[model samples]
Target: MSLAARTLELLRDEGVDRVFGNPGTTELPLLRELATTTDPSYVLALQEFSAVSAADGYARGTGRPAFVSVHAVPGVSNALIGMNNARRSRTPLVITAGQQDQRFLRDAPMLGGDLVGLAAPACLTAEEVHTGADLLPLLRRAFARVRRQPSGPAFLSIPMNLLAADEDVPVPSRIPAPDAGPSPAVEEAAAVLRSAERPAILAGDRVGATRSVAELTALAEALGATVYPQPQYEYVNADSEHPLTAPSPHFTGTEIAKALAGHDVLLVAGAAIRPHVWTPERPIPDGVRVVQLDDDPAEIGRSYDVEVGLAGSVGATLAALTALLPGREADRERGARIAETLLRERTTWRDRARAGVDAGGPLDPASAAQAVADAVAPGTVVVEEAPTTGPALRRALVQRDAGDYHNSSGNGGLGWGAGAAVGLALAHPDRPVVGFLGDGSAMFGVQGLWTAARLGAPVTYVVVDNGGYRAVSDALPPGFEGTRLGGVDWAGLARSLGLHGTAVEHGSEIGPTLAAAQRSGEPSLVVVRIRGGAS
Candidate 1:
């Protein structure tokens, strides 16, 4: 078999059913093989950014490493932003870019830049394939590394000459995942939680990535502890509707300190407390005993000192802790009180959102988000990118499943949500997929709409057209120049890209329009106009 054929077979063996990419000259060989094969299909994107972001979403959806093949140097460069997002979220992905033939190295070919060096910053490992013999080994290593606990993106640069070569490489075995057993330190960690008057659990992206939210919920219930998902979490780490799942405070050291103030013991599971902005006060307050559980040991005690570090898989460790610390009457009573407080706070938020709807000029961010929450059906998958409206959206939308919600890695990258929405729709065809995007963020990856149209992916994009980059503009000093944006018709843009499109100028129209768009079962966009600046 040709090297390209063998590579496809290996990917199939490793559970990658589709390859997302925008092909070029160097990628033709693999593209040809993909054309001939039926098992592992190719999903083309208009740009490398869309391709990588699509793969990132697919990986998060399937709980497996996704495969992507892009053009050599420029393609790798185009893909870097999405790769950075993937790396930050620790999403498992195997990204390959085709390089120029080996014989042209001395000639300084157009696309002959060093792929490994360019991709290294965003990948766990990046290597160039020298010959056909080196192909399978490198591919195997990439798959293995990405599937291991604390999984992440890996990059491989394969030359066109090697891919076209008819060298008979050995059939590769399925890659093995590293053991995800709980650590022996779970006993000590449980002891700390059990002794504390108030225990708190912090869930992070890995909890959702590993499909361990159930275990997280179970452990929280067992200890009767309040659960808070990490700030800027890439996935739904806990069910939003769960009583123990409290809203995360504002992203600042002072707010985090205030929220976590009463907890005597904090279980840092698959998350490190991260604040969006720095402040003088520590995020984790003093005298709070910390018990950290993580598959990646490097994360344990990385920020604050920990009383016990449980290095293991999040699900296994949480399950072990739950087994060790059974529920008690006092714990149950405390949990009930916490649940009551959370319920009251949520009711107030809903009331505020309703008020926005009633007394509206342009829609408030909270009211617009509430409309989306009301429109989406149960089991719908929501992808978040509206930085201005996101907090309101989170509070309003209900996520009952681990994979029901996803968002950008919060690594300062903007174009991910548009393409990710397409990929997510493709991944979960049975479930509705909705993308809540800022008008500014949508423009960054707006080309993704064409791919969604071409593939017939059922996705509803809710663009909160607030006219500008409100999230950034809100932070800037008054009278700052060059940030304001307006005048583009988002619905017209979506229609031009071959999807059904509509605009909602009034607050009351938001929910009905979104509901209609989602029910269409075709890629569509609803541009909901709202007041601009500072949300």
Candidate 2:
């Protein structure tokens, strides 16, 4: 078999049913093989950003490595933003790009700039096969490495000429991921938690990535710990509406410090304390003892000093800790107190959200988010990229399922939500998907709507049209120019892309439009103007 044919066969063996990419001249060899294949279909994106982000979302939804094959140099560069986001979130993706023909290397051909060097910054591993016989082994290695602890994007640059070469080669046996058994420090971590007078847990995206939220919740309940999802987390760390849950102070070190103020023991579970802003206040409060648990050993004590570091599978370690610690029955009084505090905070936030919805005027971000939250279905998957609306949306929505929620990664890349929503819908056809995007962010990924329309993915895109890059403008000096955006017809753009599009004129229209679009089980877009910019 030709190398291209063998590559597809290997992908099929790995259970990758969809390959996402944007085509280029160098990629034609592999595309020819994909064109005739019935098992692993080619998912085309208008841009490389959408291609990579969509694959990232698919991997997150399916809990396996998703595939992407971009063109050589420019395509790889175009996909880097999404790649960085995937790397930060630890989404397993085996990304490949067709390099220019190896024969012209000394001549410095156009579109032949260093593919491996360009992609290495965003990939866990980036290498190029020197010969057709080496492609299979390189791919096998990438697949295995990308699924290891702290799983992330792995890249390979395959020469177009090599892919078309006819060579008989032995496919290497698949390397199975090693089981991360109980951590040696689980007992020590549990001892720290059990002895604490007041404790708080910092949960990360990996909690949901590993499908360990239940274990995390149980551990939280056992210790009566207030669980705070890490800032800019990519997945559901804990249920938003759970009584033990506390709001994340995303991007702000001072706010994070405030959240950690009263806790004596801070248990960091699969989370890194990397607040975006620079503030004098330390993220972890002074004199607080820290017990950090993560499947990736590098993440433990990565940003702060830790009293105990437990490196093992997040699910297994959390389960072991829960088993070692006293049950919820022992902490009934503390649990009740924490529940009351959370309930009171929730009530205040809801009241504010309700007050922000004025029928005669544009809705506030919280109100708009509340409407989307109200409209989501029971098994809905939500992907968020709205900077202004994120905190409000998190407060408004209630997500209980392990993988129900995801967001743009800490890399702070925009344009991820639309493609991610499409990928999620494709992965879970039975579940509706809602993508909450800031108008600015939506424009960055507008091309994804076409892919969604083509695939008929059931994604309801909620564009919170705040009239500008309000997140940036709000922080900039008052007279900063070029941040304000106006007069773009978002609904019309969606309609042009062949999805159901509606412009929400009032707050009352938001929920109904979203619900109807989701019910239709087709790609759709709802644009709602909110009180931001000059609005």
Candidate 3:
């Protein structure tokens, strides 16, 4: 069998039924082979950035390693931004790039740069396959690493000549999943939780990635602890409507320290202690003791000092801690107090949001987000990239279920939402997918709309067209120039790209417009125009 055929067979064995890519000349051999294969379908993207972002979304949605293929040097370089996003999001992906024929290496042939070197910084494992015999083995290793703990993208550069060559290689029967049992530290962690007067759990993306929401809830209930998600990636960590759940505070260390001031013990699980984009002058609160549990030891105390760092599977560790803790019945009074506090905080936030919505004129981001949230179906998946209006959206549209919400990683890339929504719709064909994007963010990878329309994906794109980079304008000091973007007809652009388009200038039209797009059951876009002056 050809090396390409063997590689496809291994992918099939690993249950990868789709490949996302934008092919170039060096990728012809593999593309040709994929054209004839029936089991694993090929999903074509117009650009390499969309290709990688699509795979990232698919992996995050399905809890499996996604497969992606791209051309040589330029393709790898174009894919770096999305790959870095995947690494920061900890999405499992196996990204393979085609390299030029090995025979012409000394000649410095076209598209013959160091693919591994280019990919190494963004990948968990980066290597080049030199021969047909090495292809399957390298793929196996890549798949294994991508699916391992603290999962991220892996890279394999296969030369075009190698793919065209015929060599027999042994395909492994099965690759075992990584598992870490309970450790002794789990008991110590439980003791701290049991002794604390007020305890809190700061959850992260890994909790949802591992499908441990129930375990986390059980642990939280046992300890009568309040639960908060990591600030930047606030989705699927816990049920938003749960009595013990609290909205994730701002990412600034000083803000977080203030939010968590009253809590005596902070148990961080499946997330870093602190991931901040901008530094603050004030330090974290000094009184609280932090205990961290993660599958990756490197993440335990990387950001802040911790009292105890437990390295193990988050699900297993939580299960062990729950078993060691006393019954929830013993903490009934504490649970009641926590519930009352959470309700008060939630009420205050909602009142403030309502006031903001009422103060704005005809079209406002908060009102539009509420309308979209109301229009979407029960099982709809939401991908968000509207940074300036994201807080209002989150506050108005509460997500109660796991795997229902997705956002950009800590890297905060602009074009991630459109491509991710496309990939998500492809992954979950039975459910509707909606992308809430800023006008500036949508322009980053607008070509993804073409792919969605071509595939007839069940996706509704809602662009909050507040002119241009509103987030930038809001962040910079007054009198700062260069952030203004004049009117752009995003709906007309979508219509030209073969998607049904609707434009709305009033809050009342937002829900009906979205409802119409959802009823059409085709790729559609709703352009919502709002005031673009200060955030």
Candidate 4:
């Protein structure tokens, strides 16, 4: 079998059910091989950025490493931002980019340049394959490194000629298997929790995605422990309204550390607890016991030396702890009271945000976001890349119980959002999928609108058009000048992409516009035009 076939075989062996990518001439050989194989699904994205994000989201949702294929130079460069986002979010992805044959690489053959250079600054680690035989080992190393440590994206490039070439190269030998599960340290963490006077559980992405909220909730309730959802990466628990929740302190940095330190013990579940999330000015109070449990080891003890570090499946660890922790009525009563308070707080906040928000003019970005969120049934899927307005949008679209809320992650790779919406829409057609994008983000993958339109996807897009790359410009740090990205015409672009499109400048036009798009039967776009700087 050709190296392309063997490489594909390897991916299949890795249990990759699908690959999300955009191809180029250099990747023709692999694409042909893909056509011959039916085990791994191939998802065509409009751009490399979208392809990478699709892979990222796929990994995040399915809890397995996903593959991404893209061309060298131009394509890889376009995909860099999304890769960066994946790295930031620590989403596992194995990315393959096409490279010109090594013979002409130094001479700058067409579409040939420094791929490693372009990718290294953006991805976790990137390398090139020198020979067909080099692939098996490199693939093994790359995949393992990305999965084992930090768990982000790793890149492996193949020369176009070699991928299509025949050689004395035998199919490469298989490598070591990947290991994932909770560890022996669970007993130690439970011991700490059991002995503590006041304990808290910090929930991160793993806890949320692994469906470990029940265990976490149980542990918290059994000990009267406070449960705080770490706002970044992953979120746990159904909602702040759910019973058996103890609201964590709103303060981060020094205050968070102080609060955590003051406690007799703190159990960090699914949280990286990296320096960025904690305070350095004041250490966690003296004598505080900090225990950590996570699926990935790299995140365990990243900030402070962990008293107990357990590496295992989040679900397994939570199950063990829940089984061991006997219920205490005093703790249970405290937890119920906290849950009630949080529910009240959440209700008050939602009511204020939802009040007449439907009647706001020119469609206030926050108000519009709230309206769309309210209209959707729970359990509806959302694909949103509405940058600049993300913080406000997140608040207004408070994800309550039911459905999944997906964004571009922390990567902020603009173009990936629309295409990811497409993948998610295809992944779960039974649930309605809605994508919200700022004009700038929409520009990145609007090509996807046409693809979705053609597929007859039930995907609806809410375009917040303010005429510019609002986030990019404002995100520039102090003293940075000449911040201008010109502008993008979102409505025109959407229509051009073969999706039924409309621009609504007035608030009165929003509900009807969204309602029509949602029921359009085919993929459609609704662009809400706003005055500049509305992000």
Return whichever of 2 and 4 wins on TM-score: 2
Residue 71 C-alpha lDDT in model 3? 89
TM-score of each: 0.97, 0.98, 0.95, 0.83
Better of 2 and 3 by lDDT: 2
How good is model 3 by TM-score? 0.95
What tens digits encode model 2's per-residue C-alpha lDDT throughout 1-535?
8889888889988889999999999988899898887679999999999999899889988888999989988899899999998888888999999989999988998888799999999989999989877899989989999879888899999989999988897677888878888689887888888888888999987788888999999988888888998887778889888899988876678989998898999988888677777899989989999999888999888888899999888899899999998766657678889999998998899888876665577787888888888789888999999887888888888878777888974678889989988888888888889999989989898899999999999899998887888877887776566787788999899999999989989888877788889889988999998887632
Q: Model 3, 1-535: lDDT tens per residue?
A: 7878877889999989999999888988888899898669999899988999888888887878999998899999989988988887888999999999999888999899999999999989899998787888889988888778778899999999999887777787667876777656987787778888888888877787778888999888888888887776635788777889887777777777777888899988887544455656332467788888888888988877788888888888899999999666657678878889888877686665455443435466766666677678778899888877776676666676667888883576678888899888988989999999888888987888888888899899998877767767877875565776656788889999889988876667777788888878999999887665443
Kindly report which residue stretches of model 2 are placed more than 4 angstroms away from their true locations once superposed: 328-330
lDDT of 1 by residue, 249-274 (tens): 66778988898998999998788566
Which portions of model 4 miss their true places by more than 4 Å?
34-42, 121-125, 140-149, 168-179, 195-198, 234-240, 244-264, 273-289, 363-366, 392-403, 412-414, 444-451, 465-489, 504-516, 528-535
TM-score of candidate 2 versus the correct structure, residues matched by position: 0.98
lDDT of each: 0.86, 0.87, 0.82, 0.70
- Could you tell me how far off, in angstroms, the CA of residue 500 lies in candidate 4 after the best superposition? 2.8
Ranking by TM-score: 2, 1, 3, 4
Candidate with top lDDT is 2
Clashing pairs in 4: 85-411, 181-312, 181-313, 182-312, 182-313, 205-234, 253-279, 261-285, 379-402, 379-403
Error of 2 at 134 (Å): 0.9
